[model samples]
Target: MNPTAPHDTPADLSVAAMTERFRAGDLTPVEVLDAVRARVEACEPTLNALWWSDLDRQGRAQAAARASAERWQAGEALGPLDGVPVTVKENIAVEGVPMPGGHAAGDPPTATADAPITARLREGGAVLVGATVMPDWGMLSSGVSSRHGITRSPLDPSLTTGGSSSGAGAAAAAGYGPVHIGSDIGGSIRLPGTWLGLATLKPSFGRVPLDAPYLGRCAGPLARRTEDVLAAMQVIGRSDPRDFSALPAYTGDYTRPLSDGGADVRGLRIGVHTDAGCGEGTDPHVASVVRATADALSDAGAEVVEIAPFMDEGLLADVDRFWRVRSWADFSALDLEDQRRILPHVARWCMAGADVPAVELMRCYHSIQRMRATTVAATVDYDFVLSPVAPMAAFPAEQPMPYTDPSLPMQHIGFTVPYNMSEQPASSVHAGFTPDGRTVAVQVAGRRFDDAGVLALSERIEEIAAVPAPVRIVGA
Candidate 1:
């Protein structure tokens, strides 16, 4: 195993800090990748964060890292994230890996081309370390998929790390790398980031491409710092020929202003969303952490005000229904034999939605339109909005939801789903830890295409929150 930097915290190993070290001749890209690989190896056996390591490609990654190191030595790095080690979530295509999408058994065909976001990572000089696990077609909120089993939280092996970006969150929090590419349709990115105490961005739809066949899903970045997400956004948000969904504006460097000026929350009108219209229950600890984040923003010179749920109850229910039916049909259409390979709860969840009529699906669309209007009206007077990313902290790793009640499908997702409907930029940053030590996260939302603004606010929140300790493998 590669030796540790003396008392290095996860924050100290952030992409920004590592680049500075590289520039100062303190480390090489190969050395950083080696250490990250060591960390991944140590954590993988227990946490199950990875689906495939792509060992055959390590030589190429090392070669790229060496090239990046040479550039850094000559004071000419390739890009903002040159040489940073990054992990891609499994459902997003990586050119040479088997993407099982968390099924129990199948030798899936390797992707012949990289996903647009993956191509962007390469453009930024990021070394793709491996692909991480996700739920079957990213259908569930917990990490217990049929193929990879359960992905435990880095903080506590018995608890969940969140899904369908489950393994990405685990890898990020476990010090596997500084940046992890994840996808979110409902709360996949934010849920895992919240439960695992990492910084993640779910950019405005079209800010990042929806290269895969699914609707409403977008690629995002998860990292130890919001700045890293911003850096990644600058790369992956570029328009690609492969995704007709990508917007054409191509404004340069999402991270430039935030990186140059630092986060300034002053004079911004912020709305706090504690209850997201759905009657979903919130854990008291989660609520307190969110309120504390609002208080911090208020103290940081931003105008903070409490706000009610953005979408109406019926609309919220439709959103849930949409996901249920939509997600089900995507997988249930597979051969009956293949369908049987999915995890029980995930299979059941998808099956429940498979029978919804075409008319019902149209209602879902109508509800989404109404939701977009509601969210726009609510945020029109404000520059940003704040809310809890999830209603609760990490639950048992084996369970599909935070609660056993029948409302489980709608429970944890209430705070996050609206943004997906609104196609707004949203992020989740560490809020605090529960007394039991599970991490809580707060969501920051901004106007459409205002990913930078959302990230800036999240950066401020990250600054005030305590950095989670790096997970140590005891008795390894």
Candidate 2:
């Protein structure tokens, strides 16, 4: 799309590379957006990564790109990412777009104003290409949805791209654009990042403000390269008045660590979490990739050690129970006719909470508190912890869950959910591939409020591991 590299290989499609070409007069934002939109159109028939809303996304994005080109020609460009193409999650409100939450339940109304994240993207001069699709209410990690249908991975059409952030992952892997923003409550961003072999960050709970922030749901960037994610965080990481849950605006810089040569790791203690303590144990191949990644960190002058499993079936069960009750409450409030439109598995999963007693719900809440405290204390000694993004690789796109049952829905999230409850910053980078070509990735977790440090370390690990990038598309 950028004309330097073929559409399949996205090396030149990265934000940093594209903007550099624009500055040298070798390209124009209009040209790039046109080419990008074309590529997306070509891939859409198979990937199904974008959501079609009533919003005039194309006209608006084209206008923004034209303005950026004029600014560059007049030497008044806004910033490095002035004309970068970005796709927002459909759930996040953009002016005049309905917040469907990926469901066909109601006559969803349009937003009168942009969400904080969307507003920041506009202020930073990013062109809003369109919105990406997600599973219903972001409840499942798989791509199947009642509203958007199944979003198969670009790398392997049979396998899922993983979700809540489903369409964003599919778009990134297919090179739709450099920035595809998504929300991560329990590894929604990083899970897909791993399955699709992309780079994504689920920053500290409040690093990027959300219009309707929840306990551990934070909005962040997803791209093929960590550099692009950093380019995006530079803009959306600002403070906003809308989210009462957000931390004070971030004052630290995210770019310096990369420019100044990543984080100094000579003395950093790194912990390797090889066992998740519940669910099907980590696949041998997945465990091996993680260990190799840790070895690379050890070779980089950091102290690496193994950490005992601090999680169990009970903790994961509690998380599932708490979320089920939350989902049930939301589903109950919807109009009775609308509730019937939910995906069958989701309906079955959430409705289980309808019969729970108040005492059971309180116990689930208390178990979450225990998990938070335990997760925080377990990693206190290490500057960061390295683990697999999941216990296994991607599952079939048509499947509703890895376990394929609503009652045991979240067995795959054990390695990721604790961090959400603990409010820690975590990221996923491509590690390697399984023997069968399924993508494998590792998660990097850092102390609370150390969002920048986590990213800097993640970049360094990416360099050290140097895993081969998955092909642009596999089995297409």
Candidate 3:
């Protein structure tokens, strides 16, 4: 591994900090990537966070970093994330990387072209180290997959790093990489961040372009700090001609000045949903963490109100149907044998999609489309809506994933998924730790295009909570 940079701080240096170091000639991209590579080599045997690592290709990345450093030395301009090393979740295509979608047994075709977001990262001068692991077809909440094995949390190797962005969160928390690019359709990014004590952004739909098949899923980032997330969003947020679903606006700057005072939430109306429309049997720890987070925001000068109407219970079925249709579309392309060989939960979820009638699927789509206006209208008076990312913190990794738990109601995903169905911007910041030592995350939902606002709120909350770096997995 490359020797640590002279001025490199062991911790608290986010991706933005590292980028500044690169620009000031204090660090090199090669050094950053090498450090990450060494960490992965040392940790993967226990954490199993990576799907694949192309060290030879990374050598080429090092050469490219040298060229970028030379250009900067010659006074040429560099992008915001120039020379930063980031990891992409396996589901998103990275040109030349196999698109396993988390099922190693299934011989899915390799991606010939980069996903739009991946291309944007490269254009911004961020080096792609490798693809992080995910659940098979990203169908479950825990990281146990037949393909990649289980991914443990950095804090405790016995606990899970939530999925389907499991590896992304694990890698970030473990300090294997500064930023991890992940996709969230149903609490994937936020849930992991919550469990691992990290900051993650689930941008408004279309902010990051996702080509065919996975279009409904929003691409996002997981990182140690909110600043790194903001820096990454600036790059991957670019509009792509390939995704017809992508919005028409150019990428806007996500970094902004925090509110005047650490306590300045003045005039900002915030809504808190402790019940989260999850019906009965919500975890007390989850409720307590969320309420505490709301109190912190209220103490920060924001008017926090308990609201229920903002959450629509009718939206769950439609969201389920939407995912079903998308999963079916992707699964149909695979050979029958390949389909059979996929993870059990993935196969079960995709099989359910085959049963949904075309008319019913259309109804589900139309229902979601029509409700977006209503959902947006309900939040017009509030600057942001706060809630829990998941019903509970990360659970133990289960072998045969549970698709639908009879004990937990359909609204188990209540706090999330609706925003995805509405295509609005949402984010999760580390609130604090639970009594049992698990991390807790608070969800922030903002206006359709106001992703920056959501990120701003996260930064403020991070200050109030003072989240600590996740504990590295022991004996890895």
Using TM-score as the measure, the top candidate is 2
RMSD of each: 3.0, 2.4, 3.6
Superposition error at 351 for model 1 (Å):
1.5
Higher-ranked by TM-score: 2 or 3: 2
Which residue ranges in model 2 land beyond 4 Å of their true spot?
1-5, 8-12, 53-58, 258-264, 474-476
Clashes of each: 0, 0, 0
Top model number, lDDT: 2
Question: How much lDDT does each candidate structure score?
Answer: 0.78, 0.84, 0.75
All candidates in order of lDDT, best leading:
2, 1, 3
lDDT of 3 by residue, 212-319 (tens): 525347889998788889888888887888988888876455775534533367778898886655333357897787898888878767899888744455566676
Candidate 1 lDDT, tens digit per residue, 1-476?
Answer: 11154634332377777888889998888888777767766778889989877434347777778889999999998777898888899888888887887777556778888888888888888888889998777877788888888888877788888988999988887777788999998889999888887789998888787566355677799886788887778778777767777778677557544432567677778899777767466788989988988888788777898887765568767877787887677676678787778777767766778778999899988888888888888887888888888877788998877766433456667778778878888898877878887788889988988888788778777776545533433112
Q: What is the C-alpha local distance difference test score of candidate 1?
A: 0.78
Full-model lDDT, candidate 3: 0.75
Ranked by TM-score, the better of candidates 1 and 3 is 1
Whichever of 1 and 2 has more TM-score, that candidate is 2
Candidate 1 accuracy as TM-score: 0.92
